[model samples]
Target: MISGLLTGLSLIIAIGAQNAYVLKIGLHKKYVFPVCTICFLGDFLLIWCGVFGIGAIIQKFPIFLDTFRYGGAAFLFVYGLLSLKNFFKSSGSLVAGNTVSLPSLSKVLLTCLGFTFLNPHVYLDTMILLGSIASAYGEPGKYFFSMGACLGSFLWFYSLGYG
Candidate 1:
């Protein structure tokens, strides 16, 4: 359990679209609970895919991997530049007031889906890497590992949203 938890946390600690979005929503304090819940649920879904042998299908397609990798990298670089631009444009504190106007639940869900699906790393982490690792532990261990992964996602989004 401990190892599984650590593996899950460690795998997701690196910066990515979902994490960036979560942090953004957290700092903005807008639609926080829903946004965070979406993140957690998204993570859970992807982790399940990885743990359930779906990653093997993804692994078989080298061209797909390459395409996704390059595209995701481009998206990250652009997203980073945009963030930096936003940071530089505003003089006021990012923490000062709620800059993010809360949107409707539908919009929030769409945004979460966008944050999740627009990038490929989510698939890589949840399916390729986490799935591979979880499969190593057999059936019961796989479940434990998945539980840990789910918990990690929950904790991370909860912290990002509430902190």
Candidate 2:
């Protein structure tokens, strides 16, 4: 369990599209709970799917991986362009007291989805790598390992989101 927790943390600690989005919205204090929930749930889904052999299934089709790669790249690119454009503009704070309105909840959630699922590397880490590691534990131990991993994911997302 400890090992799984460490492994999950090690994999997730790196800053990437998902984490960046979480941290950005967290700092801004906009839709933090929903964003964090989406991240944790996404991680939980991938981790469990990986433990159950989805990694092998996914690997069988390289085209699927390629599609996610290109699609994720495009997603990040567009987000970057939007950020750059907004940087020059005087969009007010997302805080409660601010006069400038927040973006629609639907749009923010959609962006969170892109950040969470569109990243192929996240699949590699959570599904493939973590799943492979858990399989080595065999039987019930694998379940324990997955539990620890899921707990780690839960902790990291909430901490980073609400910290």
Candidate 3:
């Protein structure tokens, strides 16, 4: 379980787009609750799926992963171009950034969901990586490991959100 906790933390602490976005919104004090909840839930569900059975199934047939990877790549490429355009259009100052109107709740929710699901690395981390590790623990041990990992994820996302 400790191994699972540490491994989960190690994987998540590597400052990905999700983490950076979480920190960005957190610092801005906008939609922090929904953002954190969605992210943790995303991790929770994926880790559970991986720990229980989806991980092995995915291992057996990697095509699903490949599909997600390719689709996510395309999505990310478009998202990156949009972000670049936004950056160029802005004055590149915090004050100017703040002048923009509040985005809708639905938009915030969807964006959070996108950050969770649109990134292929997330699947690899929660499903393939952590799932592979939990397998080493065997039945009952794997459950404990899964719980530990979930707890770690919960801690990390909430901390980043509230801190």
Best candidate, TM-score-wise? Answer: 3
lDDT, candidate 1, 38-154, per-residue tens: 788888998898888886676686777777777777777787797789789877554626564646768767867767765787877787788888889997999898898888878
The alpha-carbon lDDT assigned to residue 110 of candidate 1 equals 82
TM-scores for all predictions: 0.81, 0.88, 0.90
Worst ten-residue run, lDDT, model 1? 93-102
Q: Which stretches in model 1 have alpha-carbon errors above 4 Å? A: 15-17, 96-109
| Model 2 agreement with the true structure over 38-109: per-residue lDDT tens digits | 999999999889999996677797787789889988888888898788778965643434555458889889
Alpha-carbon lDDT, every model:
0.78, 0.87, 0.85
Candidate 3 local lDDT, 13-122, one digit each (tens): 88877897788777667888889999999999999888877976877898998988998888788878987898899875433236565488798888788889989999
Clashing pairs in 1: none
Model 3 local distance difference test score: 0.85
The better-scoring model by lDDT among 2 and 3 is 2
Q: List the lowest-lDDT window of 10 residues for candidate 3.
A: 93-102
* 56: Cα error in model 1, Å: 1.9
